[model samples]
Target: MAIDVRIPTILRSYTGGSKAVSGTGDTLADLLTNLDGAHPGLRGRLVTPEGGLHRFVNIYVNDEDVRFLGSLEAKLNDGDTVTILPAVAGGALGFAAAHALRG
Candidate 1:
């Protein structure tokens, strides 16, 4: 399946400053892996070394938080929109850190 992933402004640098990117996969994990393949260091920001989602990040599928649903195993249909959100502490500082680290 092909899905649209909305890259938050804080993490756009990893996608070469793209706000949205399209990837093909059946599950969220696969989609993320594909994205990381295209944008180095992206997977590390979203998922931990233990293969779990990072605590500071939340992934939404079609406006529904995937954590409340199935996490990275969430099923993705064609055209689904996945939004990557990184929790912010101090607005600017958090965003800047996300950009620098993920970029």
Candidate 2:
């Protein structure tokens, strides 16, 4: 199965400056493995040593957030488009917490 992956700016160096890449994998985990094989150090950036997704990173398969869909185990079919978007919070979480405390 062929999967499309989006490369965030922070990790584009591993992709030869490309913002996107494509490869084949039967599962999301396998896809990530293939990415690591191709890019060398990409897997370290995406998956933790314990094989868990990084806290600040989010992955989407066909526009569905994998966190709600079995995380790294989320299945993908041929032609699936996976997007890797890292979370960016600028006091957003703190603001929300403070607002909740005031209520």
Candidate 3:
């Protein structure tokens, strides 16, 4: 299946500064493999040596968190959108401060 994978700002270097890339795979794992073939070293940042997603990384398929849909095993289809984002942790006051800055 042809999939559109969205790359976050921090990882754009691997994609030659492109924010999104196209890859082919039947599952999320295959997608990453194919992606790495074209964008070498990209997978290492997303998957760990243990063959699992990095703890601080979050992956979504078509707007749904893949963790709820079998993680890397999540099935894929043509035209599906895959988003990879870094997870952030902060206390309520920290969040308020960040949000206040946006005002």
Candidate 4:
């Protein structure tokens, strides 16, 4: 089944700057495998060496967080849109806000 994968800007390098790509897999894990085949190094960024989702990466299938669904084993169907986003936080603005709050 063909699945649509939305690529985050930080990981666009792996997709040759494409914001989105397509692949085939029955499960999320299988989709990653297929995507990595077309775009080498992509899977490594999403999946840890121990075969689990990376701590800072968040995946959503059909607008639902995969963590609550079954993680890598989450079943996928045709035409599902998968969005991959890196958990973003901890910038200078946050630090400054914390300092202001303390004062």
lDDT score at residue 28, model 3, on the 0-100 scale: 91
lDDT, model 1, position 37: 82
Off by over 4 Å in 4: 91-103
Q: How would you encode candidate 4's per-residue C-alpha lDDT over 1-103 as one tens digit per residue? A: 8999999999999999999999999999999999999999999999999999987899999989999989999999999999999987677577667889999
Q: In model 2, which regions exceed 4 Å deviation?
A: 90-103
In candidate 3, stretches whose alpha carbon ends up further than 4 angstroms from where it belongs are: 90-103
lDDT of 1 by residue, 1-103 (tens): 6789999998888999999999988999999888888898888889999999887898999989998878999999998999988876566466667889988
Query: Which residue pairs in candidate 2 have backbone atoms (N, alpha carbon, C) closer than 3 angstroms, thus clashing?
Result: none
- Return the lDDT, model 4, position 56: 81
Cα-based lDDT for every prediction = 0.88, 0.87, 0.93, 0.95
Tens-place lDDT per residue, model 2, 15-100, is 99999999778778889999988898988888999999987888999879989888889888999999998887557467568879
Worst 10 residues of 4 by lDDT: 88-97
Worst 10 residues of 3 by lDDT: 88-97
Q: List the candidate numbers ranked by lDDT, top first.
A: 4, 3, 1, 2
Question: Which clashing pairs does model 4 show?
Answer: none
RMSD of each: 7.2, 3.5, 6.7, 5.0
Please tell me which predicted candidate would have the highest lDDT against the true structure: 4
Candidate 1 residue spans exceeding 4 A from truth? 89-103
